[model samples]
Target: MPKRIMFTMGDIACAEGAISAGCRYFGGYPITPATEIAEWMARRMPEVGGAYVQYEDEIASITSVIGASWTGTKAMTATSGPGVSLMMEAVGLAVMTETPLVLVNIMRGGPSTGQPTRGQQGDVMQAKWGSHGDYQIIALTPASVQEMFDETIRAFNLSERYRVPVFLLADETVGHMRERLVIPDEKDIKLEYRKLPTVDPSEYLPFKPDDDLVPPMALLGTKYQFYATGLTHDERGYPSDKEEVQIELITRLNNKILKNADKIVEVEEFMLDDAEIAVIAYGTPSRSAKRAIKDVRQEGIRAGLLRLKTVWPFPERHVVDLATKVKQIIVAEQNLGQIYYMVKAAASPTPVHLMTKPAGMPQLPQEIVQMIREVHSS
Candidate 1:
């Protein structure tokens, strides 16, 4: 259980984290900024008695991962922007069927292959709504290489616990950045495995949830013969078209995450004890927010940072509370105000300004401090 110091990229650390979390199946395709994850998984999976496959495309990659997940082992996949676009249908399939899996999206600049080498968080909103229809997702944004390692492991835990697809939304900057990461001994890492069915073969239901709205998932090879489909399904996993069944099916899908918002979302507040303005950021932009706060604090200004660790379920309550305390809020993001609009909606009555830089570069601390000054002036 000795701690080991290893200097590595965020993607490499993420692959290692998945391995540590007992992920036995990695089905992925190689893509820039995220290929290292797949490469590392290929090298390490077999050594640990796990399976790794380089699929034909992103679509096939995710499709295979979803199929592997039904076998009751932890499953994962990694890709960049375009790959995420290709996996949208697969995402919906996983959601509709309530299959648990972890997807790591190492974002690059994009509407369509925008910037391959540079890191831009243009997928913030897309991650939430990319898949058609209404379903809630649990997404974690890591601010550092260390968090990239830590959060990926947590992503699998959340995905398994909720029986839903979870995302580790890392930007290209973090994915490519190399830093010293602490590789804790395997025995020290607390990992979460999905809940399994306990009922007799005659009584098993694939979509039937326990009290937590997460069902006891049974492996495909088990004695029970279960069924799953993307169509509206009842507790028995059979397709149903009746209004009452449809209502129950969709509501449970949304409620499993929305109702458990308190348990599913996490946020970190820095130096907000008595702040007049706040900087709201996550992922790479939050790094600038941290530095900006330190700079402003020395100038006799009361500024703070509200960094979101779990972005989805969007931290509405915490954001509103901080807005109530502060006179104004600044949302700094690498893209053109993807999350800024969300902050404005939640922080009503309190002015929320957008500090957006879409050139695929990280926002500088000075720029954020200047934005804070503007908030003070207005």
Candidate 2:
């Protein structure tokens, strides 16, 4: 039987999840709402024979995690809004180089230091487009401490399997809340590592993609003498100025995740089958949405909750399908209206009601309930 334990904060559970998922390397700088993750890793990594380092800044921290990941170790880092902004360049590097690493962003208000210790989901759009380029990123959002534990493992697995960087996008309330988490045993969990070329160094080409469009990664000091460059390159990892090679490389980079979106997307539905009003949300706001739905149901209103777990490849198709059945869709988010537009676009003809609070705090259940009532009356 799996052991169940109560955690006081989501950051603690996230750290524990990384450890359980075989992450042996952690590099990060301390920041609000997410500092506990780095602190926990600092104390726990030593006991597990893993390495944890608090770098001078977020740039160095993310780059170090990428470096460690290339050495055949599962590596990860955690940060909040401003820290994530600082790591954007490194995130672009990871995507261009196809580095399998995990980044946990416990989001707070931002543009630049909007809120240090407060809660907000303003980084939803940033996670998708912060890095400059047409590359695809896999980002997951967790609503509770238990999800923080579970989704960290999934983020790592997706990073390794897809041979790309993945993001665990959490916010303040979810990062600080305590909940009972049932962690799975090692045998019960399926872990994936990047595929390595079987051929000798002389015959190996690092950027040459396999059948799955994922190239086997080579270690820096290994027998392989391959090069990794930010510029467009062919199968041999050399910098090529050829337009065709550039197109193919960019297409493959974007399509690898885009084509396999079904495998990467995850969401939860509550009373969606018969619900006339659908409440769409993620992270901490999702918890409030669930509560709001329960309250509305008690009042004989046919309401439901659609909690998104995978936020990057935004569950557009699922939202579209759900829209056909619901009379109105209410999006409750900590941000003003980041995902609200996506849900609206997905729902098309179906009306989308926005219930957003841009303040540095979690959306209250009462506020969500009020939004639902207003939408119902309208």
Candidate 3:
């Protein structure tokens, strides 16, 4: 049996998870709700032969992680809303250059540091489309400290497997809550390393897509002499202003993720087989959703809960399937209908209701049960 350990906050579990995942480089600036993640990494990195550097700002911090990743090191960074805003450009750079890195955003109130220490899921949409471009980003939301450890490890593995930056999206409550987590042994977990070029340096093409749709990566100090840029480029990594090359490059970038979305999307279902009403939620709100479902079930509502572990690359197929079976779908999120819209779009013709509270506090179980009662009455 696995031993269960208690954690005071989710950020500590995230730090422990990254370290266990073989992350050796951490570059970040201090920010509220997420500052503890950096502090934990700083204190623990040296003990694990890793390095932690507090950058001058968020932009530099994210850029430094990208640079470290390009040098064949597993790198990560953590920040809050305002800091994530500052790191958007560097995130775009990571996408364009195909840098495999993990970014943890312990979300607080947004729109210019609205509430630095308060909880909010307002960054859900931002994580998907924060950067200025047409690209696919993987974002995972954890509802508990146990998930903070498991999901952070998954984020790094997905980043390395897909050659893209991955987001570990957590809010203040989930980032700060204490829970008993079962830490896995090192030998049981499988870690995916980046694929290196098998051909000689002279014949290597940096951006050449392989059979797996992921291009082989070459480290900066390696014998391979190839260039990398953000602009639309060919397989040789040279910038091209041609419309055809631009189209192909952008299409490949988007499809590489979309085509393999089944391997990326993850969710947890509870008592869904015979449920008449279903609750859709993610992050901290999902915890309330789970409890609310139990409350409604005790009241003989035949309700179930669908908790999203992967927020981005939305689980449309699963949502549609559940919608077809359930009479009503209730979406409870910290934000005011960000993911609710996607759920509605996927479950067309099925009545979808929203139970949202964006006041920097998580939705309560009673609040969700009340919404379900209102829906059933109507």
Error of 2 at 363 (Å): 2.0
Candidate-wise lDDT, in order: 0.90, 0.90, 0.90
Expressed as tens digits, the lDDT of each residue in 1-378 for candidate 2 is 366566468999999989888999999999998999999999999999999998999999999998998888999999998899999999999999999999999988777888877889999999899989898999999988889999999999999988899999998888988888777766787777888878988999899888778898888788888888878888998999998998999999988888888899999998887999999999988888888889999998999999999988889889999999999999988888999998998998999988878877677899888888989999
Q: TM per model?
A: 0.98, 0.96, 0.98
Backbone atom clashes (below 3 Å) for every candidate: 0, 0, 0
Q: In candidate 3, list every pair of residues with a backbone clash.
A: none
| Collision count of model 2 | 0
Tell me the spans in candidate 2 whose CA falls farther than 4 Å from its real position.
Answer: 1-4
RMSD of each: 1.1, 1.5, 1.5
Indicate the residue-level lDDT of 86 in model 2.
Answer: 93
Comparing candidate 1 with candidate 2, which one achieves the higher TM-score? 1
lDDT of 3 by residue, 2-114 (tens): 44466568999999889878999999999999999999999999998889999999999999999999899899999999989999998889888899999999988877869
